[model samples]
Target: MKKTTLLILLLFSLKSIGQQSKLKITIDERIETLYSVAFFNDYFLINNHENLYKNTLKNKLNILKNHKAVQLFDSLSTKYNFSYYRTVEWILQYSNFPEFNKTKNKADDYSTVSENKQFLLEEFKDELIKFNQDTLFQKYLKAVKPLNAKIISQVQNSTTIDELPSYLEEYYGKKLNSYNLILSPLLHAGGFNSEIINENGEKEVYALLGPNGEIDFVPYFDKDFIETDLILHEFGHSFVNPLMVKYENHVESLSSKYFTKELEKNGTNQGYSEWKYIFNELLLRATTIQITRQKFGNEKAEKLLNFEKSVGFELVENIVEILKEYELNRHKYVTFDEFYPILIERMK
Candidate 1:
């Protein structure tokens, strides 16, 4: 009886270890509110998809077109070079409306909020609450609830979503405490990710993805879009960006040597102006290619590699080759970070 009990307990432990966590896919009211304000303030005016807020919600929320929050955002955008993704990052630090306090720190101690902006947000807290209350944001959320439910249901059923955590954890040799996929109807074509170190010192990652369009009054995600762009690429940033910070000097030196004017121009056009940003993006894209190859197949991976190169990431193929070496020598390297310097040296 004792021997049989031990065997059953050991099998249960192995089964538990084998089970990977699925992504938590839902619409966040805080993100929706922030983007709604941004949309009315003309923040998404440039390079965003035509399908942004084109559904029934657009006309219903027009009363907030001139809200104080919108005015403040407009003025701030004019005064500073506040990129769309930067704005999203700033908003992610704050708690949900009515309080709007900065409750979350950026993961890995990278501060995205300027001290001046921080102070301004603290001062503007009441007005933000007023904006939320007066504009009937809860009512807007209620209207969006069913659409949110539909998208969540669709995403929960995705095989790619189910497979992502295991693939990423195995690749990085690090486990995230949680994964969240937040759907934003107002975000359009842009996808953003936030890595937050929670109060418990656990890493929580969020993939903020936009809707492609509404189908029969419900927001829809293109299967290919979710699998490749939103899932692999965006979440890959969480793993890659923090690791690159330690090698910033090496990246800058490499950029000086190889990041040509044309490459800088291409990178700047895609919102990656700095050497570190471009380097981090190259690493992330390369890793995404490698993960795709492992998860899907070589043909799909080759197609993605070609697409990335066409879009100005010319060095991605080389990075992918380096990543291949890392994969084969996991006994020597252990983690991708351990093999990063080899990548830096080979890039030269």
Candidate 2:
């Protein structure tokens, strides 16, 4: 019995180490911004996001539209919208565009970049040529090739890439030990999105970085708060969105009858395609506030809550109160999967 128990402990130790090893952070300016630009081409001027493009980023979008690459990417002769998005996703996931990946030799630090500008441009064109023989695409690549430097420079100037990973591990990483973290921070990538994937028995949380459509990253630099809140909020989705999938029926059963037209309209304004997004936002809002309170005390946490409220999360405080109860006696509810049903029932 003693020998068997010792073997089990050894196996558990190895599993812990293996889980920790899966967290990775990649900052690639070229491919990341390329993905962003391609995404802009796909969605720019479309009804869902048309107002956004016209109001805040009209000038940038106009200039980008004239770029050879944007023209070619936007002019794709595809039957379905999925094909266009799929093509860009394929490039981002597989192309491995080296121009952005190349970085100057340094002490192997997080901030190092390959500084050969001319070499970077040449490689950019060469890679595009390999990907497609279209002359228009090649022109697009050249026109926006210079933008990569601008994007990378902005990222380098804004914050240390190292700080992102360190904070993730320090604040909520261990608490979220059930899943692996995959972070990709990109420049000029408009808007943020996250998803959780379960492979076999392991779950991985993936978060993508995009341009701040609301505020410029530099002037609004409350690095400790802004960046931390963004990570917590996105990572919060990993925790809550999965529980949503598990309790889909329970969620749908929450009579949509109670949702006022204004509420439905508000949901649409919040960019939610369905009621699930509202639920996810509520949970994330509460989780972020709770975590902020844990780290910075109630005063700072209250300030953050107000900030969120001013930005349209008026329901946040009420939602936090509901989550606080579950948190206070957490052992009774080990995972969010266990706690959510009660919260939903109460909301109904």
Candidate 3:
């Protein structure tokens, strides 16, 4: 073909690709929460100071006014749902997600490069030692040691996963024969994976109960740590699914009706201040749960012993960037597959 004709054809092909491309922008939901309300609620939960609830309304509104989302949402507050947490994801625009097709370029999946845990643990001892020196970790270790002893003691007598069924039935007083789950959480080197469910949900958590009705521990322990406390937290959701389902309906029954009415208010307040209040509240209420733990108790010694707060403050700084990125990419549906790297980048 002539050079001029070839150039024309190439231009047309490029134009066609752009025309057919699904890279068009779309509107994010118009509804959103004002910082004033979310921040106030967070403050009350965190400090347990009833006076925080009675703060001047003007002071509360000023807290999160700097936040861009707070401003945008405040302008469109009329379109919001009952709560921002429940209804932030107001729309789903279905399209082909961005695929890297990086099978050839991607690193190989983690594998058993070593023969066993004894060798792997030894090899990674330096990294392990670093985590071991945590001042706050003494209590965590004390709690885990007894649990580890229980498993080790059971290993000699309770040989199989089937044996766990009877052991659990006697210990827990529940017939779990029908509810079976197998967990092998290979912390050092294992593929974190899934369970049988009605649909493919990335966030689903399930466990296997043996014939006698307990965690099928022995079978999976050689392969992984099945009884990690984080696992129990996931199972708790399912355990109280019925009660959690009705919590919204009767929330006022368990609490003062006046307070409930205040929480439902919305005003465009400063976003950062609002988030600080809410985030601090979460930190306070998040239980350590060895037996029973309370944060910032009336005890003077407890109040004096405090985290530097620098670490958490830094974490919040990076999370704000993450929130901004999410807002900017609502049209593109861009997302970070892993937030850890950004966290490290900001911290270190």
Candidate 4:
């Protein structure tokens, strides 16, 4: 009887571990609150304070802004072309804190901020250490920790994280359980962002869930909202970015022709180099629209398309016909490799 019980318990434990949700959600109140302190301080420094979180954060942001640690960060930012907030991000990623510890790879160098191939944090390691030790940042973090429960509830209601993978699977007509998702609910003040990083020889997506201004203070749950759109948009990057890199030569050859001066000038707003940026932007946008249309009906998809156009992706609507053709004739093109080249040829 004892042997049977042990075997049963072991099997149950294995089952539980195996059945764990591919979508892992965490409300990293400390990291988000820390970033909020920096972001709000930066915002106030540039413009008159008009944020919704001003009343909750003004004093904290002010204190952080005046701290010697932040001053050192500012000086370093000038030298490095990366902001103090970015340094804080790197600190949280590298710190003893569990929330951020697994978000970066052990192999990648953190000397420079990865995005945009920007400045070196290695040069200012001492300054970064000093900034992380600042009493003000710690105090502000403690003061705001109590509000995390409420903030987490608000963010959960505003976005649909739990059902996202299932939605993506149903839309794309494939199994996506291999891809692990890290849903980090950031403070309402911080903006939304997402990135894919390789950690422990596995690809993990760290996505920031921020304020949904569309339904501000009106508590309701709907995955079809723009919150889903934002997630799909970022997730689309995880799909398209790697493929672009995999087919770098093919992408480069086509990019020069497709990326006209008009597209370059229009797409440079995000600081990405013109042709490469435009190509990625269009690929991600089209992927977003295709999957969104599958999950939601035509009306919602049309709204998403127009929204992309209004944001300066004026050529996206024309791609829909080609994507439709791809879907109808999918058997001919088994992979994106087969489909993408043909699609680009049609673009010509």
C-alpha lDDT of residue 263 in model 2: 55
lDDT of 1 by residue, 82-147 (tens): 555666666666788677777776665544446667655554455566767764666877766776
For each of the candidates, the C-alpha root-mean-square deviation to the true structure, in angstroms, is 3.4, 12.1, 27.7, 5.4
Q: Can you rank all candidates by TM-score, best first?
A: 1, 4, 2, 3
lDDT of each: 0.74, 0.49, 0.27, 0.54
What TM-score does each of the candidates earn? 0.87, 0.57, 0.20, 0.72
- Which residue ranges in model 1 land beyond 4 Å of their true spot? 1-22, 45-53, 108-113
What would you estimate as the lDDT of candidate 2? 0.49
In model 2, what lDDT does residue 204 have?
Answer: 41
> How far is 194's C-alpha from truth in model 1 (Å)?
1.5
Number of the top candidate by TM-score?
A: 1
Q: lDDT, candidate 3, residue 185? A: 17
On the 0 to 100 scale, the lDDT of residue 97 in model 3 is: 14
How much is 226 displaced in model 1, in angstroms?
2.0
* Number of clashing pairs per prediction, in order: 0, 8, 14, 0
Can you write out model 2's per-residue Cα lDDT over 1-348, one digit (the tens) per residue? 999999999999999876553334434433434544455465442323222223323444344445555444444423223232233232333334443332222111221113433343344345444433445334544654444344444444544333443443443333453322222222232224332223343344444444443232221213444344665666566556667878877777763743456555666766664666676776687777777777657886788788767756666777788878777766677655667889888777
Best by lDDT: 1
